[model samples]
Target: MMKKTLTALLTVISLGLGGIGFAAQGFAMGSDSTEPAKKADDYTKAVDLIDDEEYAKAIPLLEKSIKEKGEYADALNQLGYANRKLGNWAAGMEYYLKALKLEPNHLGANEYLGELYLEQKDLASAEAQLAKLKAACGDCDEYDELEDSIDDYKDDNNIN
Candidate 1:
């Protein structure tokens, strides 16, 4: 009888410690955050819509996320992408600049901003964004994509 009690106590202690560890990990990962998740949900939905090429639909969701969570660089970057896809150059530029202002090292924003520059045929400006990307995340996909774009632009325009 004593041995059974000891075994049960040990099991309870082990389970309790494991539960505590799991809770701590969740909290550290923000899964157990006290903050509301609506803003994150909005951003996630916007990203899904963007993935589907529904830029028009994603705009409002991203805007709502930005309104709820001010200075959210990711949402702002996606907003810029949506607007750029819709051919709203000025709006796209505004959002991208705002995001970059908040987080200058944002890889996606820098890449999209560079693409916008390329759209305007401003090779110098595009190259400047590429340089920033290279400095921020050396040899990253953003840098590679922008470099490819610059190369394509140069080839297309017969520019050395």
Candidate 2:
């Protein structure tokens, strides 16, 4: 009984910190809906801009957010995405890896990093990140097409 209880507690804690915690983690807006403090609003607003597909508009916002919170992995990750959409692949990918550095197990960051690596013909790095995600993913909820995409990339690149 005690073992079961402990297992349940551990499971709950793990799920709570999964992708569901993304916004609240304050990397971007975190995984929650609550507003950030005034000082952190730049990051929060940047996230909103990203969602609206205003990548160009998001640029300075994200830059300012990071200036205010250099270690905010979420902002870094979103900035990467924004840059990617703006055809700034190199810079976008740089920020993606930066986010991963700040939060090693960040699933979205990991998946995006793998995708970017694949784009650059960096199969080794992509494979490494995919392996990490395969090992640590909880629901694997967001990885459905991601794995298939990696496989496709390898086949296209003849990376085998």
Candidate 3:
């Protein structure tokens, strides 16, 4: 009887530990693991909308993606681009700043933020962003694009 009791207790303890192990694993994998995938799907959809020049349609998806993946620099940058394309310069600047704060070397954020600065006629700030992009990737497309934008801005305003 004592042996049977001991065996039953051991079985209960083993099951309890096993349950705890499974719960821990599940908790580890639940939100944190699945969130990125959801965010990626949203980001992809947002990008497709943006590519179609549907900034209004892309905003909500980008916002959702950013919410799901907090501090997602790419999503933030894309949000900025969508807002800028929609003529929401203030909102675009906000998202671009957020993205830059999260990732100072983010190519797209630097480029878009530079463009926003140009739109706001903040040439110095725009030049600063261009400098950052240059430092990040000297001959990259982002650097070249922002450089061209700055040049155009200067030409338009006679800034030399």
Which candidate comes out best when scored by TM-score?
Answer: 1
Ranking by TM-score: 1, 3, 2
- Better candidate by TM-score, 1 or 3: 1
Stretches of candidate 2 above 4 Å error? 1-39, 152-160
The 10-residue segment of model 2 with minimum total lDDT is: 30-39
- Each model's backbone clash number: 0, 9, 0
Tens digits of per-residue lDDT for model 2, 32-144: 22235523677767778888888898889878866775556677788788888787889988898888777777777777778777777787888787788887784484365
The alpha-carbon deviation from the true structure for residue 58 of candidate 1, after best TM-score superposition, in angstroms, is: 0.2
lDDT of 3 by residue, 27-66 (tens): 7763211244546687889889999999999988878876
User: For residues 1-160, could you state the per-residue lDDT of candidate 1 as single tens digits?
Assistant: 9999999999999999999999997667542112444356888888899999999999998888877777577888899999999999999999999888878998999999999999999999999999999999999988999999999999999999
For model 1 the local lDDT of residue 127 reads: 98
Overall lDDT per candidate, in order of appearance = 0.88, 0.75, 0.85
| Superposed model 3: Cα runs more than 4 Å off | 1-38
**Candidate 1 error regions (>4 Å):** 1-39
Q: What TM-score does model 3 achieve against the real structure?
A: 0.74
RMSD of 1: 4.3
